[model samples]
Target: MISRSSQTAAIAFAVLILLLSASIGNAYEDVGVSISIKGTRSYKLKKEAQLLAKKQAIISYLKRVNPSAVGKSCAKQLVNDRAALIKRITTQEISQVGDYMEGSYLVRIDDEKLNYMLEELGCGAQNGATDVTILIMEEPPTKANISMILNPEDSTGVRKLRGLGPFAVFYTSYQRSIRDTIISKANKEGLKLTRLDTFDEFQKMRMSNDDPLVGVYFDDESEDFVINKRLLKVVRTRFAAQNTIVLYYRIESLYFDQVTRELNAAIAISLYDLNSGETKSVGSQDFMVIVPKGQSSVAIRDGLAEVASNAASLLMNQAKKQIRRMASIAQVHAQKKGTLPVTVTVHLKSKRTMYNVKKNLKPSMIRHSEIKGDSLILKLTKGIQADDFVYGELLGVLEGMGIKIPENNINLNGQEVIIQQ
Candidate 1:
């Protein structure tokens, strides 16, 4: 039995303990932090520095809160616990305010979120697993955009009909050889070539036609083929080349000299940077072949082959040079733009189909990916943008690899692309 005063004192003591316990539990509930990343001249490198600063901020905060729990080996240990760390360190918002000085970037980090992450990693609490956050640091590969232009008149005209086409056998043979050689050379160099057949196709489809070099015309017709440079400029503006290379080639002239009994061919070649609209003639070659007075099928075939071989050799050499130039351009562009983010969503029709999709995805292209039930979300390397062309290209690639992508099931909204089986 206690007195009234004693009972009141006992109740007060219990209340005091409850308050202390609550305060202890909520000690690190909300914290605030500001981190400044070192200056970098390159915008691409700036992102990398910022990511490092964020990681250091977390380590520093943990050390300040509980040195004993985090220990001296914390940084090394956190590396192994990245996945767990990312799950716990969540923020309502993260803002990049501005540059601190020179090229340094200033960022605001959520203190509360940082503290919570530390707690989860056994910084000041027990019964928790250690956590670590991972930041993607590597830049993605850049894609080269190449456009091939051919002179419309190159394939025109009537001459010694050796082949099935209306054109002279030599003319037809030379055209086929040049086209095939350029395409083959481009393919060997791992270039993605875009071939536009006609100026009308270029206009109607809204294809890129910036530099005048992109309009190559073989002067085969007796009438001169006039070009509208202004229309080309308009087309370029609407379809900005950005990081693209345009290639142009034309058969300047071709004729048969009956007195000399020789077939003469003149070709001109040029390369253009669509991004800058600058043009340079890589090289030009003039070929001549002696033909017999009486033309036999064998004689015609042999003459045509000789002309084609010489022309192809010259064309191929220029193509190789252009390929090297494109590689250099791609390297510089990648440094400037970093990597383009692409989100791909794959809708599954069946469990087997889901497995197939996962398996078929290129490992090199995938930066990060996750599957939510029947749908797979992938962050793939950027080469193809979210456009009708890309969608069609993707369909073709997948189909080629034995994946059936229904035509009506594909959708692309900006970078959020979806493909249903």
Candidate 2:
């Protein structure tokens, strides 16, 4: 022990052990995996196949350095942080088979991240629940970019009703109904329903589409991440789990015939493969109603509201299968990439307020007329009943916005309510 040569030999042995440990800590292995998923022609199949390959590869990598973590209750944790794990994964030799869209892939996961994934799983810390937030798109879609991504049909005035406002009573009630059903269904699926804290901000930016049939879609890969990164940035800032899911929905279109008293409407929902910024799936359903020939307008209105609202919920049930599958893919891809219009009467301000009056006053007024300043011509079908309904609605809107007008200042007419400036 006292000799210099002996001391040097001991020191060398210690350094070698340190080097070996470091090497061990950084050990990784490439995995060859084959998978075939059943689906129509869609990138969704490819994405699913890749996730399977990566999962196999991750397990394979852990088998080499940390065999103890090979099997465990790691699923919950995986669902939550799969995005970061996905970022650490690499794929190659991807080949596709016919209509099945089957594929085999060579997959690899980063050593450090692999260890982290396993460690987190082993600790049982992550609840592994996916956070799901649901939002209804704002009508008229504040931004021009929305039309750029929406299908041509979605962009048509017949579908979008651009420059027109939807009836708040009709749409918001349907939205609330759908929202409640979505939550109840999601709860059954065991997903952790966390708030999509950034969604409101996202809507304000108008990067999303209001068309229920469209939802939010990005055709270009670059733009996908650009939009996703905004959400991810919020996730990071708020320390949200990486795999939060958002569902965007809206009433696609609705029509009513005054003479026949028949109603027809459709609603749609769209989901995306967030990492790639591509549409994963879109689901829509139509509902129709024939109001009883002699029913009061109030009864017809209430019945229509109930039918539209309940139809959207029923459609959610019909689309539940697709939604669940999309949510699953959403979970897998989530780890891969890393992560609002209220028309309130503003003191009954401009001629613009007439849009609200017509939409709220008489349903036909909204659909058939291009309302202009102080020039409303009441249809013979709309009478005292319509005026009472519209007047009450106008008062509610003003009060809702925290706006007040003394009766003395309110110059109310049969179809107009203008506040004195």
Candidate 3:
């Protein structure tokens, strides 16, 4: 028979071991893994990195919880088959915890959900060890705000002017300096700048484009006293139906003020939305140099630079207001229905037609889309009964890309829209 003192000591030791095991299991419940990958700063790249980080974190958690099942061999296999594994896993709940550091990201995965996924993939623990719960905490995904700046090319062409009219044109001499300043300011304000020479380039760039809450087009060329009605009409027809909010700026006049005996410069500013197809004047301000009567040309140039800076500041403030309004609309829509599905069917002409179409649509707006030979079935996210906005935007994009869709060939049935070339 065992001695009573010995029995008590054995029980105490067993209890302590159990307690330690519980503590260890609890420690492995939540896991955070840091991932560093070199890639361009883009929505697609960030999303891919996020998925990869999540996969790494989940694998790490699995290894900690069940070393035997998720050992070196399993880890190697998971890494090799990550592309397939990523499709099976859902990351709607998983959150990226911090800002990307030197292209590195911290990803947190819920232990329970991860284990479930692993088991579903036939990579569960050998002995059904299930005591891990450590998960990285992260803020929920929120709506994104974006802004863009467009720079006009010096050379002119039918395609070029077609792409850049109504927006201010840049003077060849100071275009680079002004562009650099705008970029710097936009960077400080967390805005995205799309540097393009022409609207044709803009169309090509739009395929994988970010949705801009505000678009500021810089045109610094001196405007003619008489507006060209024919040119303006053509521009209106081409770019009038865009859904983006755009601010256009141009130098109206620059001359020596005879009465004030000073150099005077005026810039015309306008704000318009392609959605509404109207260009409303934002403001026109004159900058004057009232110092010495005989100022050097350099002094006049300096004065112009100052005026340009002031115009940029005013434009940015107006852009912010537009962004706020857009945000409010989005918030209201989100409250009503977080997302509504709209199906789009497009007739295909060539093999690359669908490819081009996919490139132009915003990725965030697309919930799911599939191309079936000559036809594309696109499921988009938007507000309920907002088909007009969707169809109008699509029409504008299609028109910009030189794709023709006859009015009679277009059809809308409830949430589904069909367009034939």
lDDT of 3 by residue, 1-421 (tens): 7567656654553454344323321101334555555554567766776667767765664445444445545566656655543433333333334543223444433333344444455444311221111110011111111000122332244333332232223233233343444444433333333343334423432211331111222222532223333333333333221123344555555444334544444545554544344455656555444434344334445444544444444444344334324323322333343235666767657658777887888777777777765566677776534365356577777888898777776766445566667
Each prediction's whole-model lDDT (CA):
0.44, 0.43, 0.44
Which sections of candidate 2 miss by over 4 Å? 1-170, 188-241, 273-275, 330-421
Better of 2 and 3 by TM-score: 2
Tens-digit lDDT string for candidate 2 (243-359): 323455555665545566565556666654333344534566666555434444444444445444545555554444344455445433333422211111123344555455456
The TM-score leader among the candidates is 1
Full ranking by lDDT: 1, 3, 2
TM-score: model 3 vs. ground truth: 0.33
Model 1, which residues run further than 4 Å from truth?
A: 1-177, 197-222, 226-242, 296-309, 339-421
